[model samples]
Target: MAIRGKTILITGASSGLGRAMALSLSHGDNNLVVTARREGLLRELAAEVEAHGSRCTVAVADAVDPAACQQVIDAGLAAYGRIDVAILNAGGGTPTNMAHTDSAAVLRIMRVNFDTLVNFLCPMIDHMRDVGGTIAWTGSPAGFFGLPRSGPYSAAKAAGRVMLDSARVELAGSPVKLVALYPGFTYTPGLDPNDVPIKALIIQPERAAREMLGAIERGRSHHMFPKRIRVLIALGRLMPEWLRRRFLRVASGG
Candidate 1:
């Protein structure tokens, strides 16, 4: 639970919050199994993790593929004998205008966000159920409600959130701990700053990672960060449906 001297597996370690988390957890005598499609970035992250006084194993694979997910889990088990924690952080989104987007495009976004989580989630749950470990999912506040332009993404995350909720209830008596992390607009390579209406609300990847790690370390069932976003989400839920839609349209620059 402290995250020290434990075998941890992180997906999407090539960049963004995932990479930041790897660096933050690199210290404190942790054993890291970093995986992503990008081999070069994983290697770079591994070197940094080792430099920071932790053991790291690079496992290059796609999070969308269930088999690849299993292999990555096996790689961690092979390297450390057991994985005490698993962070499902592989996900992304692009500006999608649902009105003009095709079914394939919408499905692509769904696979990127939802499928990636499921691919890793299933295998990790099975392995952790017996050994007892923590599984933290990188979710989003966007999932709490449908944002105007990000419908598909919101849907994906909402589905993931509900699934995790169900898993938490089902595994109540099990030793595995399930954590859901919701991060706001984070400044990372994948983000376009101009797309964000309020630049001030955007947080750095390091801060996001820190909060995520803190949630996992504390074994929190769910954590949503940056006070502003949390307040906004709460307000949105309190608003009437029509008013909430209007607010969302204006916020999304529609």
Candidate 2:
């Protein structure tokens, strides 16, 4: 599955991981559908993607909104005859204390992180099952465990991890491939310092994007950035629940 000539739709393309992926895949003949809430930035991205001699369409959409997410899919279908890859990369972390975090804030985080995936999955699955395609949901190291100050992010990403991993059994042998792309402390504007158990080994968004695209091209089930964290996540899962909780507490400024 070379990405060169494929039609791919990417959310959160205004900046961060989504932007990096879009730029990286811009060189080929792929028809790109890039979406974000910021219309101005999306227009600029369209110019950049087109400069590479590929087709690009910009859609101003807020992934947290169900209507906006559907619009993204519709925009892609209208621009390209078919969709080959969908990068469900809209997400953010909210700083909240467990003692008394606002429910509204938690819901916003979940909407951006989890609900968007579910909403997009409906159209993605249907289109892919009928015409064939691939979907990559952005999971996070936060998904691997619960952490203080990032409870909502942790829970939502954990749910994403579970969903993408389990989707394989349901879609086995189908032309459509589902995957979870997990990144730990990857570089992004204002989110560079994604502190975790370890302070070192954080990577840039482009590096992780390369790995993710490679996995998607090869049809791998899941792709984890900064392999060190993937190994640590495996270890954490093997640890006792009490020990995992204690470790997360210490790692997350408890």
Candidate 3:
């Protein structure tokens, strides 16, 4: 409920929004269990979190691996005996090229954005179902509707969006709170504008992380930020299919 004195487990803590979240929530009352592929960055973050008077544990593993996800959960339980919040924030995607229809690339995108979340979701629900904890996923507005050039990413996040909706229904009376966080155009590492024309809506990782943390604290089932993007998504949903496709083509710089 309140963010203090909670055991918060965050994946993808090596950099970007995940790192920002770890820094933002690292107060004396909190115990941060951070995991990611980058052990070096996790160690650096663990030190900072500890310096802030909170306990920190680093679990270096791939979030897409179910066994690694389990190990991260176990590490938190081993240290604090409970996890009050779990943030599944590991994902990334490349701009789609219609001509380059590589099946492997499509699968990799799905695994990164959607499968990774599922890998962590199963274990988190099982462990927190009875004890009652918050489970948050890093969704995207691309999930709300399919984008023109980022088909794989949009499809993956769309799956996550619906899956979390189902999870909310199933965990209705349980303590586990399911949340889907839709962050639009975040300026985080490995997510550059490059050719994508989303620069106008980009927000820094710190600001996005702070807002996300607040939303989670409030126990919201779904949250989207940077008012402008929400407006765009709303407008996009109202448009005809062909019109929406044209809008996405321009917005995504296709």
Which has the higher TM-score value, candidate number 2 or candidate number 3? 3
Candidate 3 or 1, higher TM-score: 1
- Measured over all alpha carbons after superposition, the RMSD of each candidate to the real structure, in angstroms, is 1.1, 1.7, 1.5
Error of 3 at 7 (Å): 0.2
lDDT of 3 by residue, 94-113 (tens): 87764677989888899999
Candidate 3: minimum summed lDDT over ten consecutive residues — where? 190-199
Per-candidate local distance difference test: 0.92, 0.83, 0.87
lDDT of 1 by residue, 21-104 (tens): 999999879999999999999999999999999999999987788888899989899999999999998898887998888999
Best by lDDT: 1
**Candidate 1 structure, TM-score to reference:** 0.98
- Which tens-of-lDDT digit does each residue in 54-116 have in candidate 2? 899898876767787888888889988788999998888867676897888888888778987
Error of 2 at 200 (Å): 2.1
Candidate 1 has an lDDT of: 0.92
Question: What ordering of candidates by lDDT runs from best to worst?
Answer: 1, 3, 2
Instruction: Tell me the TM-score of each prediction against the true structure.
Output: 0.98, 0.94, 0.96
lDDT of 2: 0.83
126 in model 3: Cα distance from truth in Å? 0.7
